[model samples]
Target: MKQLLVFIRKEFYHVFRDRRTLLILFGLPTAQILLFGFALSSEVKNINLAVVDFAHDQATQHIIGKLQASRYFHLQQAPLSYAAMETAFRQGKIKAALVFPANFSADLGHTGRGQLQIVADGSDPNTASTITTYLTAIVGDYQRQLNQAAGALPFQIVPETRLLYNPEMNGSLNFIPGVLALVLMIVCTTLTSVSIVREKERGTMEVLLVSPFRPLLVLIAKAVPYLVLSLLDFTLILLLSVFVLDVEIRGSVMLLYGVSTVFIVACLSLGLLISNVTASQQVAMLVSMMGMMLPTLLFTGFMFPLENLPGPLRLIPNLLPSHWYYLVVKAVMLKGLGFGAVWRETLILLGMSVALLGISLRNFNIRLA
Candidate 1:
């Protein structure tokens, strides 16, 4: 029993002596609590909207003016045609479109009723649904004002809400892409971290360090297998999502895979960075799980909307690789968007991959020195 106690004390002493391990051991849960507490929110605000006023009448103008007054929406464009509205939506400019038919004023004046068409880009079903509700409330308020002025029965505004893309509003469709993000996080960070640290623990890393190959080459070779494996895992998840889960991939599969490749590279690079800083497999695993997985789950806007989070917290998600990757996946998979639709997100992921890889290589060199 004394021998066992001594062994346990020695283990604790070793863990405490490694400053990085100690920091990770204490920092992970604190960070997770704070991140999850602050960042995960469901509210929507500041949605972009477009207007098409065919009537060009007082009532149409009044409705449009009311929408502009609301904090919930920002009027981005006034396109002349529905085609233009569709183009804007496909290009990811506007979330919703408000169309007033030619007879808007005439119908309202004659029958105490008006018709408004609310078209929402249903790629993001939650945001689209919220925008529709907001517009409906705003239009209803306008109708009430009309009735109050005339001292008559309540006027009615019929909202024809069209949800483009995802008319069904399937929750699973959104969830599957996020699941991919989590899987990638595990593969790139957790697996790679463990693999590299295992090599170090077994003295294989020391052997490679003395070999002719550069440290960067060794790190890259270590990452390539995981990169390929992560892609394979992504493909498997995608197939299962499509077949078993019945989630459709609306965009170009090739583009989705291409962007996914970039994200995988970024995540693997992040793992390399972790492995460089950590000396033990246990420490590497802890850092990867807590540092990478927790943030990917909470801060990436996978399960929660970043718009709803507090102002400073909103900026944090932008720095996470999974946030941009999830955006790209969601836009392409749900909206059927192509490269043109998601160039910004793709570029961000590409930039992150390069930056992280460069930093990891630098850290590797420093450790060698």
Candidate 2:
């Protein structure tokens, strides 16, 4: 009994002696809880909206005023043409566009009806769809207001909602792409982090550092085996998602794989960054879990919709590599989108990979120096 007690005390002492390990152990739960608690919201807010009102009438102006007054939407300058609106969406300047057709007031007064168009950016189908829903509800409210004032329901506003790409909403189809992202993140970040730290703990890292191999070559050699294994895992995931789960890939398979390859390299670079900072396998494991797993799963739109997150909290996912990967995967897999549709996200991931790899290599060189 005394021996067991003594061993347990010794283990606790060893664990507490490492300041990095101690910080992670104590800080992880607090940080994760705060982050997830604040970031996860059921309400969507701060949607950027553009209005194209060809009607130029009281009714159209009133509707535009209401949209601007709403807390959910931030109205931009009215677009002069459809081309301008498309450019805005492609440039990510707006999530939705409200178009009031010519003689909107005339149609409403004479025919008791008018057409309102809601064009949403389908790159993020979930967010775009939600924006349309909100616009529809607003128009309905306006119609109800007219009926109450006139003492009869005389006017109707018809909303033509065009959800580009994902005309048919499939929840499973959306999730399958996200699953690929999460799996790759786990394979690359967690496993590579632990393996690299294992070398450090085993004193093998010192021998490698002293050897004739260049630092970049040494890091690349260590990463090659893991990269191949991660690719194999990615292939298996793709097959399972398509066959067993019955999720169809509508886009170019080569494009999907190409984007995934870049993301894996980014995740691997992130792991190397963690491994470089950590001294032990245990610290690496904790850092990978606390830093990579929680944020990627909860905040990266992998398991939760980004639209539902709080306003300030929404910015965090943009920094995560998995966030862009999730967007690209969903766009390609569910929508059959080509490279042109997802080039922005692809470029962002590529940039993240290059930046993280550079930082990791610099840190490695410093450590050796």
Candidate 3:
């Protein structure tokens, strides 16, 4: 019994001595709680909405005021024409737009009937559906209030909804892009992160460093195989998504692959950086999987509505490469957008690839202790 107690004490000392183990014990739980509490929420808020009130009357203004006052949306002055509104949707300026006819108040007062056009960006069918539901409720509430004020009159404001990009509101279309991001991150980052670390475990890394090949070539050689493999994995995922899931790619296939290739590179570079910093294969694997998986899941915006996150928490997703990749895929595969639509996200992924690769190369030690 005394010997067993001594052994337990020794184990505790070893755990506290290792910073990584200590972190895994205490820090991991704390971080998970904070991330899940703050970021993982289905209750939507701060939807980017545009209001076009051609009527510009007292009634229209009151409804607009209520929309902005609610926690659900932040309102913008909508574009003048339908074409401009379409441009706004494509540019991701507004998630949904409410268009009121010029004779809105006049019709509601005299005839107790008016039409409202609710246009939503439907690439993300879930968010689009939620936005439409919220708008319907708000309009219904206003209609009920008007009826009460007018006494026995049924004052109705009807909302006519149109969903752009995905009129059908397919559920699979919403998640496929996110699944792509998660799969690529796992295959590319987790696998590549352990490549160099495995060499250290087997004591073969020193031989590669001393050989005729340059350090850069050695790193490239380690990454090239995974890069090709990740692309193949992406292609396979795309095929299954199209045939099995019935969510077809709407944009150029070449462009989709082009952007996916960039994202894979970014993920690979991140993995290489992990391999460079970590001392052991086990540590590398843990960091690459646990450290990365949470961010990928939370920050990618596929798992939950990012707008629901608090202001400071919202900025964290922009740091994740998967988030950009998800956006690009949605624009290309789901929205049928061209290179012009996804160029910004593509550039961001490319920049992340460059930066991560550069840092990995800089920190890579030629002389390992």
Candidate achieving the largest TM-score: 3
Off by over 4 Å in 1: 1-168, 365-369
Per-candidate TM vs. native?
0.56, 0.55, 0.57
Ranking by TM-score: 3, 1, 2
Rank by lDDT, highest first. 3, 1, 2
Alpha carbon lDDT of residue 183, candidate 2? Answer: 64
lDDT of each: 0.76, 0.76, 0.76
- Global fold similarity of model 1 (TM-score): 0.56
Clashing pairs in 2: none
lDDT of 3 by residue, 149-255 (tens): 77775544434333422234455566667767877787678767776787777877787667655667667766666666567667766776666556778999999
lDDT of 1 by residue, 212-234 (tens): 65666667566766676677777
Off by over 4 Å in 2: 1-170, 365-369
lDDT of 2 by residue, 65-157 (tens): 888888889999889999999999899999899998897889888877788889998887877777888888788768877767776554444
